[model samples]
Target: MATLDGNLVSADDLLPLALTNLGHFTSMRVDADGSIRGLALHMERLVKDCKAVWGADLDTGRIREYVRQGLDGQSAPCVVRVTVYDPKVDMGHPADADEPHVMVSVRGAGAMPPQPLRAMSIPYERDLPEVKHVGLFGVLHARRAAQLAGFDDALFVGRDGHVSEGGTWNVGFVDESGTVVWPQAPVLPGVTMALLQQHAEHRIATVTVEQAKGMTAAFATNTSIGVRVITAIDETELPDDHPVLSQLRETYLSIPGETL
Candidate 1:
């Protein structure tokens, strides 16, 4: 089971449940090889974001301890979620009486696709870009737009008309020099970004427009997807047999659950 609100699930609980309009946020299919991979980093960011956005005093150490206790040696694929929203409004209660609803859940692991993905760009931005909030209506809409365009996922363009990142993942590309270039603009700092940087032969900070125009290859990053190589961006066709993308895909699959 997964940890939620500093507590663990006991198999009697169910998900897809919500009480307030604060919305919901989730992460699933965590690799179960006894290695937390990037759990600590993710928890750190979550705590920081929560405090900054919600004035919540979340303890990262306690959160990790809950996860460790709940993990309890079950090595199957696991799903975990932490959501904050309004539970119920207390009529006539003080305005500050609203409690922030939160929960964590985990389940056995599942399969993750390893194929290189093709993506199209969408125009959207998060109202609170700093916090990874449960509110994801814009992201859902963008994903729907990608589906309409015959793509599996969507890349997001910011207000400045520059490529920011994916609606649900971060973007990285290989320049002509074979250096891995990624954006450092108002984008979410992803745990996968750190992993890729450690593994890449070369890494640099760059924007999406520069990458779309001249990148030799590209990919999306996230804990859920790990790394999804981009086969095409907009209408520009990259060579189907690009070696750089192929190598990244192969290397990515070597990680337990993320396989093609």
Candidate 2:
């Protein structure tokens, strides 16, 4: 079951519409005790995106209440998605300012798959890379092509061959000096990446496809999979486990979660 603005609604009600077609959302895992990491950052993301996408202010305090309502007393770990959209907005004039409501949905959380990913580089990029918008056809299309090509997923490469991010995750590399290097390209600043950056010393650098192969280690970060080391990029093989990677995982795990 999903809660749309404090009211229980069928999941079917989340279909695309001309007005509600545009959406800003965040996905995170809630522990068995209902604690979450970087809770304030998640709320800040919603507030900022809501202002940019809808030109309306969002009450994050009430939004938290709605999220709790969606959890509905469940004590087990679950994946939570919080989406903000306006189903009743006028579609004829999408530019007009309108209020958007929150949609909180919960589901059973799955453990991250253990296998390292064999990624293939694809020339593509996301529009409005800063916002976590619901426009994902580009990513899905690229992912499908990669799977068909015998790759686990697609790593987006700019026209200049600079590595950016994965279809649904943020990509980072560790240098020989144990520095966390983020690709200095246009990409979505994900919640998990934000959490890691806040607690770790990282640098932003422009990484070419060839330069990535020379890095000591590479990893992908997303809400669904907290962190996973990349095994290979295109044809260059990378280590699945390294001392730096283990330290990165430890750093991420050490960040205390907030009580939801």
Best by TM-score: 2
* Residue pairs with clashing backbones, model 1: 2-106, 4-104, 24-134, 77-108, 77-109
User: lDDT per residue, candidate 2, 143-237, as tens digits?
Assistant: 99999998899999998789999999999999889899999999988888988898889999999998888999999988777888899988899
Give residue 22's lDDT in candidate 2 (0 to 100).
83
Error of 1 at 192 (Å): 0.8
Task: Give me the runs in candidate 2 sitting further than 4 Å from their true place.
Answer: 16-20, 112-114
TM-score of each: 0.77, 0.93
Residue 63, candidate 2: how far off, in angstroms? 1.0
Per-residue lDDT of model 1, residues 1-260, tens digit only: 44445565433333323332353353534665555455656667766766664566666565555555655666656655565443443335324433544566566654554577777888877667656776677888998889899988888888777787888788888778777777766777777776666566765564656457578877887766666668877776555456766666566556444311
lDDT of each prediction vs. the true structure?
A: 0.64, 0.85
All-Cα superposition RMSD per candidate: 4.8, 1.9
Candidate 1 lDDT score relative to the true structure = 0.64
The per-residue C-alpha lDDT of model 1 at residue 137 equals 76
